[model samples]
Target: MSSFDAEALERAAKAARELESSKHVKAAVELSKREQNVKVREYDARKAEASADAEKAKAAQIQIAAEERRKTIAFERKAKEELMSRQQQMERQRMREQDQLSRQREQDMLEAKKQADMERDARRLQMEQQIQEERLEGARRRAEAERANIRARAMAEAEGRILEQRKNEDIHARDIQRRSEAKAAELRGAIQEAFSQLSSTLGSYIKDSTALRNTVFVGTALAVGVYGVREGSRVIGRVVERRLLTPALVRETSRTAGTFGLRQRMKRALGMLPAEEVGLDGIVLEDKLSSRIVETASATTNTRRNGAPFRHMLFYGPPGTGKTMVAKRLARTSGLDYAVMSGGDIGPLGKDGVTELHKLLDWGETSKRGLLLFIDEADAFLSSRSRSAMSEDHRNALNALLYRTGEASRSLMLVLATNRPGDLDAAVTDRVDDAVLFGLPDAAGREALVRVYFEKFVVRAGEDAPRRLMGLLPAARASKIEIGEGFTDEYFAELAARTAGFSGRAISKLMLGVQGAVYGRGEPTLTLEIMEDVVQRKLAEFDERRRLAKTDYTDSASEAVTGTAADAAARRSSA
Candidate 1:
């Protein structure tokens, strides 16, 4: 409390003490209490009066708020009515404007139609005037042409009269010349008759003499005999050379029996023939090797077309690796006649090998289309001269070949295939312009080969209506061969994995064995079991051959060492 309130409280306390001390203290205290009570009642009356004033002010604010809300509603209603009146007016204006536009479009269409009709009439009038002008021009041209034709006819008549006069003069001169020639001919004929009579008398006199007749007959007979003998000998020699000398040397050839002439041209045009110098589909090989062959074939074909000398090639690899096949195919693809010869045949010719070799080359040169001379197993005869086994005759034969092929030839392309390239003489290898290695088929190549042979010997060969395959298979025995569905690409892949180090030819043989086993069992169906059996047998055979080959090689090596040791002992003893 403030200081004033504390003072009042102290005074009240003093008064109460005084009242207690005085005899009228009770009345004084009571009067003081009454005054305090009266003050409290007055304070309460003031608070009540303030509350009543606050309530009146609150009621006045509520009345004012209700009036304001009612005015706001009235204002919103008026604004809404105004907005509706403006929207209705705008809608009516849009409808009137649209009607005006429609009327304007109809009027425009009518105007455009009227304009089009006017333009069409003008165009028709213009066209009629132009046609009339063209007709007048044509009439003027026709009249001029008639005049020109009459002038030309008059000129031609004048020229004809002049030419007729000249022809008459020429004819008179020719007649006079012919009369003179006839007279001269008469004189000549008289002289010729006299000479003919004189010659006839001499011929008659000679015919009457027996001695002259006999001499003439003998001379004629001798001449006829000598000429006949010479010509006969030449013809016989050529026949013998071609028929006997070269036939033994040649192992195979498509030169004599091949697609040729019009038939070959027709087949080529129809896309029936193989691609030209691009790839060989007849034989299968790795892509890289195949591409190289295609390049070589293309080059060879281009060289031939350009009249360049043929390039000699060497194909050296393991046996049955398609060396011979590739050579033959390349020759055909390059438009050259193919001739396959075995080098082994040359060694047996001995002293006559040179003559036979020459004959073969001469015959090859006779091919109208150039020849591709493929020598298989070339090392058989063309081995290194340094070897002791090379006899004089063989050396002579090799020399003959070297001399013949010393220079590039346009008529003959030499392709030598050998299992042992190292054994070839340097001279022989030197003649080669290109060399290719035919390796054993890899997994992919073997798989492809298996698929091919399977299709050929197993599938096609078992067909009911088997046809000739490029004249390779002449006849087919139709067998009801049933192959299992399980025999798929995976099976072939597995077979390829099993047949490691197999050559293409070996795979073909393996398939052929599968066919044989099926036929031998008298079963129409060829199952996986039968094929596996044949494969196993073929594998065993192949292993046995490999083992024998290794054994033979080892034995030869040991013998050579032993022989060298023995020779050294003998030399030491001699010393």
Candidate 2:
């Protein structure tokens, strides 16, 4: 009962209290853990519900976007189909318009062709009627001429009979009155003697009476005698003239005859004679000559500080190289008087003939303020004197030419054209102020010449006919062809080409042949086929001439070679 017992009771009670507290803490902790678990389960359920709703909304949005895309695609496809249909309609409309235009054009062309045919028929009928009328008129005129000639012959016969009867009566009367007629007979004899003396003196002064008469004659006579002399005697005379005449003769003749001398006569005849005025275009001469001529002409026209006349020029070339044409053009462009003559005509003058030549020179020097003398074939008159047998007449003629060439006057200009420059006298060559050599044309020139001919035919055929024919011509030729304003250029280049190796004279013959063809065809439009045929014929003629020339050349060459060989053999034998 004591202090120890009370201490044990207290310890036991304390132990009980401590045990209860520990149990209560354990219970509270367990309760709190259970509440936390319940809160976690509730949060999981709410998260599951939110996830399902979000999934459903997302599916709805996907379906709406798909529907919108499908609608847009359908609209685009409709628009493309509508555009294609509109394009097809427009194409059909354009095609229909083109067909209508094409038909209209065809109709117009047909109508035009019909009109052209009608016009052509009308023109043909008119031409035929005119030709018929002309033939009838010509026949009537020829009949009238025959009747007139018959009447003239009858009148002449009657007059002749009357004259014969009167002559017989006069003879009978003279016998009866012999004493009275004695004085008249003596006077007549004296007159006859004087006339005979005068004739003899004139004969001595003139080498040939025939030459003097021919020189004085003009127009047809001059042309025929100078240019158309085919007789042997005339040819011989021409050769002799080339060897004998002096250049001074022209001056002397002019002085002796005064104003009425040979020079004046020639000038008058040239002026009065009817000439065809032809217009030339695109006439390009050989380069050397063309350049020289153009330069000379330009210089002449140009004004200088020191006043001086233009320098003169000479043209040297093979025959038919257009030297004469250049000279003529120079004179025409410069507004100067032109006097043309042949070397053969100038060189053949005898002492008596000199007077006429001199007169011509004087007229050129005095009357023509600006005069140009064109001497064609000048080499014939001014041949090399070194190999020539000297004659008094020949020496004098050479001296005269030298004097004229050296002495330049404001009024006088000389232009000499020669084919054989080697034959020209040394003095004459030295005196020439300017010299231009003409050679064969180049390829370009030939092409141009062909074009010129085509153009010429077109112009001659006229509008409608030429137009129709032009379509048929070669495109190459048609593109290049150009017609001159007038007839000057004509078809000379083509004619010249056709007459290759031919002289100017021969070329003229070829042209005449072409004209003959045209006439034969009754002046119809010269179609391409017709032109080609004409060209072929011309070529055939040219070939024949070439063959003849070749034959002659070969023969001459063989003869020369044979002669040389013989001479060499003879020399060897002598050695």
Candidate 3:
């Protein structure tokens, strides 16, 4: 276009060229400006969009923070409500506890007041009692004072009567004395006249030889007579001794002749045979003690002490504890003659007791195999000189016994049995080589005693059958008892334990009682129930006896009086 417009260009070329250049420049500038403006607008749009995004993010963050704060506040509020609810419950509980404490305190105060009232009442009653007692005492004192005054008046009257009686007796004595002196002077004058006549007659007789011959004859006769009298006295002594001391034939009231050795001879005559003698084997002593005793017996038999076959033994215990039985058994076992005497009886005989003791010792010495002298109830007479009532006779008898005991004789093995050995003289105890305590049958001893007694007691086929206590096991097993139950060993043992205080004698008596009951009832067997009844009665009786024995009558009287007084006072107070 420019080429074509060359002619036209000549005319307007400069104008065109300038105009075109200007236009081009303008377009370039415009283009440049548009591009710059577009860039700036895009930058402004991006900035606005970023600013909006920032604003939205800030709004979201604020919402989130507000949500968190709301949740924390809600949680804190819930916790505060819970804390307040717990506090309220605790406050209510505290109030309830305080109310309970208040009630408790009130109850305590009420109880304290109640106890105080009771104590006050008791104190008041005690004070009243004391005051009443004091009043009674004062009345008693007044009565005693009045009685004393009356007694004084009576004593003065009695003294005056005694003095008047003495004066009358003195006057009567003087009158009698004067009369007696006159009689004496008359009697003396008569005696002097008779004596002068006898002297004159004697002088006449002395001048004769016939008188001298008569005197010689009389002297010779008197000497012979004196010799005969002394010889007669010796014969009488021998006869008395043989009859009383040397153990002669003693005629009983039935005229039956029996050897009179000692008082215990009667017992010996009825004692069991030597072969049948009961040893410790059949007894219910402790194994240690029984065995020791059995062993001692055996050993003594095989041994000898100081040339004697055995030594002295003492059996001390309660009565009926088999002491005598043991002693007899010892004698049998030791091959010695058993002789016994009651020291208690000796106490009653006085001087005769000494003679009896000497006789016993002499008799024992004469035994071929030796003798075992058992003095039962020895403490009765052999009590200490200081501890017991002593008289000249008793002392002499005790001395005789001591002398006899002291002389060691191979023939004498003296055994003393006493319930109270402590009461025995020290000298008597000193002679005891061995001492054994026969304590009340323990469980074992009781059991043994029961068996022994039962074994001996023959169980009859019928209660009506003649009752014999010698029933042995053979007889028992031989005849089936028609009774409800025969005695069992176990039952007997138990009965023994139940009969705690029963001695061998008591047990024997109990069995006898049972036998009596059975005999009356006509029962065949000794039933446990029957035995139980018997034991109950026996124990009750035993307790009563013990109480009575220990009770002092004076003390009982005082107690009765006091009790009566107190009861009367109480009755009066109640009225």
Candidate 4:
């Protein structure tokens, strides 16, 4: 009913049960009641003591809060006083600064006024001095002007007197010059008259003397005859050198044989001529071969520059292997004049071969630069002397060549080309300084050649193509050749493989065949089939030629064997 705790109620019930079970039940109940009252008193005392401690702590907290508030108020009051004191001090400093600035301004104004007054006084003094100086200068200038006028008048009078005297002297000199000229004219007239009389007397004597007139006529005729012969011989010598010394077998040359016309000169200057004609542009060879050739060319250039004897060379190769082409290029690169001759041409000359050969050598001797004498088919005439087929005239011609080439010549370089190097005379072989071999093209070289020729003949076949047939016509009208999509570098490599045994000239001819085949077609397009047909035809032709050449060689060998047997039988019969 009073909202007592359950624990206290349970403790009362337990005490009542214990008293009911006890014998002294009234006493147990009275003791439990006393214990409960005592415990209640203790609990009240502890609660009162805790309330008193909390009140004391609350009072202590109130006192601490009051102290902190008082300290905050005192600090705020001190800060306010400090701020006022600083503001008052700043006001005093401002006032003092204003007073100092006013004093400085007053001083500056006083100094400025004093400087202005001093400048004004100085200007006044300067003006007075300038005026005094100007007065003195004006007086001095007036005196100088008066004196200058007087002196000018005196000088004018002196110049006038001198001028008059010079004029009189000039007049006297003119009179003397006139007299001298008149005397000189009279003397000249007398001298002319004397010369005229003397000429007339001499003319009359010359007209009367027949012997003297004959002598004069003869002397004049002799002089004219001498001059005519000298001029004629010079002209003939040039004609011989140009026409006769240069042999007919010279298929092409880079030397300036005669004068070039203006148009030709313009074309050369504009680079219209083929680069191969002037340099080593179109030549294709193996690297090692080309290197050796270049070394020889450098040696030749050095030899020529040093004024040393020109070295003779031999180019041994199969037919159409570029020996002749290299010879032409060598002459140009060596800075030497070139003259090409065929050795076979000497045989037909009979007795005149020696004379003609001599003339060629003599013409070579006259070259300011050395002459490169390129003899193609050299073995045709310069064969071994042990052969019985050699004619007397041929032998004599060979002897003449041997004699001329025995010693190194400063004016002549001998370059011999031959397919049959073994057929060449030992004497001719001995004269060679450098020997170059032109082997067949290898696979890579053949590939390169294939590309080069294809570009020239197919890709570039147009009006830009080189002129042919003595340079009188174009090789093609326009680019009518078309390469197929299948025609690539691999195709060209296959083509090179097909043309394994072909020489450079043979390859060129094969391309020419390709061109012709294209032109023969209606559309003039180079299809793969057309190229194959042309290549097959050329290959067949090449095989036929090779077979024919082999047969000919065999027949010649048999004929020689039979002829030898016949000669032996004849000799035995005579014995």
TM-score each candidate: 0.54, 0.42, 0.47, 0.54
TM-score winner between 2 and 3, please give it: 3
Relative to the unseen true structure, what is the Cα RMSD of model 1?
34.1
Model 2 alpha-carbon drift over 4 Å, by segment: 1-280, 303-310, 387-391, 461-512, 527-529, 544-575
Candidate 3: tens digits of C-alpha lDDT, residues 1-575:
33465667686977767767784878877899999999999999999999999999999999999999999999999999999999999999999999999999999997798689879988999999999999999999998999999899989999998888797997879889999999999999999999999999888888888987898899999999999999999999865564344342111111112364442444344431122364666666767667767987776666543354456777776677788777777767766667667776776777777776776577556666666777888888788888545888888888888787664456677778877666677777665666777667677777777766655553532322322233211222323333356466666767777878768888777766766665565544567667666777788788997777642112332233334434543544475
Q: What lDDT is obtained when candidate 4 is compared to the true structure?
A: 0.81
Off by over 4 Å in 3: 1-281, 303-306, 458-481, 486-490, 522-525, 548-575
Worst 10 residues of 2 by lDDT: 474-483
User: In model 3, which residue pairs have backbone atoms overlapping below 3 Å?
Assistant: 284-445, 458-471, 483-524, 483-525
lDDT of 3 at 512: 66
RMSD values for the candidates in order, in angstroms, are 34.1, 21.4, 25.2, 38.6
The sequence of per-residue lDDT tens digits that candidate 2 reaches over residues 1-575 is 64568888999999878867785867876888988888788888878888888898888889888989998898899898889888988898889889888988897887697579768988998999899989989988998999899999999999999889787997878786996689789999999999999999788769787777766675668668766666767878744443333244232211223334565455444543223222233565656556767767656545121235434456775566678776766665555556677777654665544555555565565533366778787876777778556455666766776666554456667788876665666667555666666665554565455455444444433322221232343222222223223334444455455545554333444444544455466443344445555666677777886777552112332233334434543544475
Our model 2 lands, by Cα RMSD against the true structure, at: 21.4
TM-score of candidate 4 to 2 decimals: 0.54
> How do the candidates rank by TM-score, highest first?
1, 4, 3, 2
Residue-by-residue lDDT tens digits, candidate 1, 216-319: 89999999999999999999998766643445577777665333445656554555453344258757898899999999989988988988778788787777
